[model samples]
Target chain A: MMRLRELAHARTGDKGDISSIAVIAYDPGDFAFLAEHVTSAAVAAHFGATVRGPVERYELPGLGALNFVLHGALGGGVTRSLALDAHGKSLSSCLLEMELPDPQAPPAAP
Target chain B: MKTVRIGSGAGYSGDRIEPAVELAEHGGISYLCFECLAERTIALAQQARLADPDAGYDPLLSARMQAVLPVSVPRGIRIITNMGAANPRAAAAETARIARRLGFGGLKIAAITGDDVLDIIAAAPWKLMERPDETTLALGDRIISANAYLGVEAIVQALAADADIVITGRVADPALFMAPLVHEFGWDMEDWDSLGRATVVGHLLECAGQITGGYFADPGYKDVADLARLGFPLAEVRADGSATITKVAGSGGAVSLRSCTEQLLYEVHDPARYYQPDVIADFSAVRLAGDGPDRVAISGGRGAARTGMLKVSIGYRDSFVGEGQISYAGAGALARARLGIEIVRERLLLTGVRTSELRCDVIGVDALHRGPGTGAMEPAEARIRVTGRTDSLAEAVRIGNEVETLYTNGPAGGGGASKSAREVIGVVSTLIPEAKVTPRVSYQVT
Candidate 1:
């Protein structure tokens, strides 16, 4: 297993209660691998209860990036949220902790 | 191919000033744009304006102009900014005063107005975009400010009129950078593709140092050199809408393909439909290529027609919040911090404090990312934070007061206790028809 951070870098932006995170692959060759493993359901499940609304994902093949818009993610927005990181700027690193199967590893003797 | 160079001066209201001075002095550019307003900034500025008539603009306007005008004005580098916040006329007048004091007479400064649509918003019933069931009337007197995101038309008009400095209130962030392109290239307002490409350039350079390795340094993963004195960004934009993003020679930070790609999607939701007042810009097909050291080429930005509707940011008084923090160190510090939080939580419940929402967090452990997949490590030191949202300032104060009492009564080794309570300013959005808003420009010469 390999951490997603080894394959991509991410940044986070917030508007109201919605948090938008874009995960971009380091190499264009890894784009398809990231797309297959980093599903919206997996991201939503990774965030668990922190994200109260549905997670919508968009793909950008030309840029080799995936944009995830997490609704109701700020705990009622920055102005009202009591979270230490009101903007959820660090949430991008949290999403990077997802473990994925190593493509370089040989297939388990079938 | 004719190309124009534009420099990004300031990213936000409180950004570093020396980098902008460096841009004005060393960076060979025709236009210098400063984007200084945030979502909740105008609302707070409006409250200040209500308190004092001449104090609604950005506090650092004089300082920025004082530092940049002498160098930028003499070199014929036009200045464009949204630093006007809640007051552009006053900001322009102040800039003119600064220019005159600095012996730069006959410098024309234009202030773009009509972004404030409080009367239009109050007169009609518009549905709130965030809350569909609610209307403008639902906010009522609590609405402190309503400023529409203006397009590049007013800024373009000011630039065309030979204004040396153009100050605006509540223009779109990207429009501040794109207006100069529109004016220099003579791009028609109906040219959707050109406008879209210009928007891409603006978005990339709008954040100043973000694209120049300010926010992108990861010790081992992505190493950026000389970040302490990171230089701001500039773009050499062509008449055909393609551009190369670069910074001043020998300045700190880098302008690589990685930095460009990271900033291309910064604060962007859907890459294909980046909604701006000028056009619905499409960046899904945008490509970045490394040209040289500290330079990257950008292309493939397209756009469709605008939505004909303008988004208005409505700022209202939401509620009050009270917070308190205390620290503990040495062995079992995490245990002491957790015990302190539990004590404060129980005290607030026992004291009958009315709170709509409350959060108790142990800093350095799970304050930012709570719930599953957290709390696997034990730290030698920890800080306890107890924050609560209440309807009134008085109730909010009590929430903090309860936590402060924990320093002496509840937890052992609790120290450095601090508490604060303040009123919250909430921001929401609604759409208004384009015809209902009008932009006007007035000039002041030094």
Candidate 2:
């Protein structure tokens, strides 16, 4: 298994309760691999209870990036949230921990 | 081919001033833009205005103008900023005073106003964008400030009138950069495609150092040099709306395809439909290419017609939040931190603290990412933080008082306890008809 951080870098932005995180591939070749594995359902499940609303994903093939918008995040927005990181700036780091199958590894014997 | 070189000085309020000074002195630009307002800033500035009439502008306005005007004025680098916050007129007057003191006589400074739509919003029935069921009337007396996100028209007008510095309140962040492009290039207001490309440049340079690798630097993975002396960004925009993002020579930080790509999607949700006061910019088709050392060329940005609706940010008094933290170190630190959290949780319950919401976090262990699979190994030290939201200041104070008691009463070796209670100013958004709002510009000549 390989971590998402190895292939991509991410940044998070917050507007009210919604959080938008964009994960961009380091190489243009890895864009397809990231888009296949980093689905909205996968990210929604990854965040679990942290994001209270549905997750929407937007693809930018030209830029080799995937933008994920998580609704009802930030614990009621930055102004009211009691979280130590009010803007959820560090949430991008949390997203980098997502595990992906290593394409370089040989297939297991059947 | 005529080109305009615009430099982004300050990103947000309280951003570093030295980087901006560096841009003014050595950026070799025609216009310097400072985006210094955030979502909740105008509301807080309104509260301050209520207390004092002439004190709603950015506090650092004096220091920034004092630092940049002396250099910018002589070079004829026109200044554009949203540092006016809740009071652009006052901010412009302050800037004029600084210019005269610096002996730059006859400098024209413009103050753009009419963004304050408190009365218009209160008089009409507009539904809140986030909460569909609620209307502006529901907020009523709780509303502290209501400012519409104005577009580039007023700013363009100021620039046309030969204003050396333009100060404004609540203009769209991108408009601070886009206005200069529109004025210098004479791009039509209805030219959505060109305006869209301008918006891309504005958004990239809006955060100043972000494009120059300020928030980026991941060490081995993405190493940026001399971050301590990171330089601000500038755009060499052409009449065709294509631009190259670069910084001053020998400045710290880097401008490359990686940095530009990260910033291109930073804070952006839909790359196809980025809503701004001027246009609905489309960045999905945008492309970035590395030109040379510390330079990146960007193009292919598109835009469509605007929504004809203005987004107004409403600031209201929501509630009060009280927080307290205490550190636990040495052997069994994690265990003691957990114990401290549990003790404080029960203490708040036992004392009957009226809290609408509460959170308990161990700083090093799970303060940011809570739930399972977060922390792998126990640490030698941890800081336990307890925060609660309450309706009243008295109740909020008790929430922290309970955590402070943990320093002596609950866990052994708990030290450096700190507590604070403050009122929470909540922000919400609603839309108003574009025709209902009008932007006006007033000039102050030094």
Candidate 3:
């Protein structure tokens, strides 16, 4: 299975304690597949301890983008967080490691 | 083809001013907008105001206006900005003073006020959106500033009154750009679609150089050229809610679909219902195409009627951050740094230093990603960083004292010790009814 980064790139934003990470595909054709596989549950699980709240994903088919809003992701945000990266700006790179169903390899073992 | 060219001069308060100067001189545009306020900035400005009456507004307001006004005036480019920070009237006066000093004495400036809801917020019951249990007014003694997110109506009114420059305090960031679109096109305020489209353009341009490739560089893979001289963005917005994003010639950075896409999703929570003071903009249907080099054409934004409520950014003195960092080098550096952190951790507890939260990290090792980040080849050096949150400055100082004490306390060749204890002012969000805030604009002559 290929890493999600092979098919897409992501950018992240923070509001208070929450961070919104938008994953945009390199090719518009791969968007449908990423959208289908990159579930909120999966992304939340991937981030694990870094993200402390529920995850909500919003789809933008026109732009082939998925916005995953991670609540309580900033470790109390910049004003309060003692974390080195208070804004969680690099969290998007960590998310790019998520594994997806490799198109070349016959899907996930059904 | 009724079109308006608007250029972003500054994004946040400390954004690069040289690019703004370049945009003012080179980018031919009717309106120049500077969005220079953040969530907790007003509180800090309020604190400054408490210390000095004439120093509440943005520190760079005069400098930016001085650089931009002369160029903008000759071109008849009207300036709109939220550089007012805590005090719009003061900021407008400051801008006017700068304009007069620059020999543009005929410039008319307007300040939109009434966003400050301290009196209302203090008396009325409002709950913090995050911690619903704690009432906003309950933190009365700790509260510093409370400003509502004003909309475009006040800005449109100011522009209609023939103000050459509009200075405001705590208006919605996107509204800084959207106001010109509404005033120039005379787009109906109730028309959600047009507002939505303009909002899209505003969002893209609000962060200044972000959409123009300042923040999109990834080295070899997603390379952006000449980022050091990155030019701010300018939008050629049409009457039909369509715009072309481009930058001035002889400037740095690029305007690509990737750059635009990264910015398009920046800080956006929901793609379908992006809420603002004026409208609920929908980016779901929005379309983007690469019109040419350094040019991306965008359209198809849909907007719905606005919510009756408006967001209020409340700033309060949260706590204090006490931090200390000391470095160690050579072969056994990692082990020494780890020991240093462990000592600071236990020392803080032993000293009975009041701490709300404590964090110990080895900077070159696990500080960022929680483990040996990007270091397959053993690090030659490492740093120990210990930070703690405390209620009082005295307690905060104690936390740093322990780290400084480590210098002689031993950790093997530890040097370059730095320590600081600073007050932390945090911002919280709350919603208030739109009727409570009556945004009114008044003008002053330079």
What's the CA RMSD for each of the models? 1.0, 1.0, 1.8
lDDT of 3: 0.88
- lDDT digits (tens) for residues B1-446 of candidate 3: 98899999998999998887788788988899999998888999989988987778999997888778778898899999999988888898888777878888778899999999988788887989888798886676898889999999999999999999999999989999999999989899899999999999999999998898876787765788899999999999999989999999879999989889989989999887899999999988888999988999999999999998999988898999899999999998888888898898888879899888998888866666542134455579998889999989998988778888889996879999999999999888899999988998899987
Interface RMSD for candidate number 1? 1.1
lDDT string for model 2 (B1-446, tens) is: 89899999999899998887788789889999999999999999998998999989999999999988878888899999999999999999999888888999999999999999999977877899888899878887999899999999999999999988999999999999999999988999999999999999999999988889888999889999998999999999988899999999989999989889888988888889999988999999999998899999999999999999999999999999999999999989989998998998888889889788999898999999875586667888999999999999988998888889986798899999999999999999998888999999999898
| Candidate 3 colliding pairs | none
For every prediction, compared with the true complex, DockQ reads: 0.78, 0.83, 0.65
Off by over 4 Å in 1: none
- How accurate locally is residue B419 in candidate 1, as Cα lDDT from 0 to 100? 93
Pick out the ten consecutive residues of candidate 3 chain B with the lowest summed lDDT. Answer: B369-378
For model 3 chain A, the run of ten residues with the poorest summed lDDT: A101-110
**Per-prediction TM-score to the true structure, in the order listed:** 0.99, 0.99, 0.96
Candidate 3 regions exceeding 4 Å error are A99-102, A106-110, B371-378
Give the CA lDDT, 0 to 100, for residue B391 in model 1: 93
Task: Report the C-alpha lDDT of model 2 over A58-78, residue by residue, as the tens digit.
Answer: 999888999999999899888
User: Which is the better candidate, 2 or 3, if ranked by TM-score?
Assistant: 2
lDDT (tens digit, per residue) of candidate 1 on A1-110: 99999999988888889999999999989999999999999999889889999999999988889999999999988777889899999998888888999979998998
User: What CAPRI class is candidate 1?
Assistant: medium
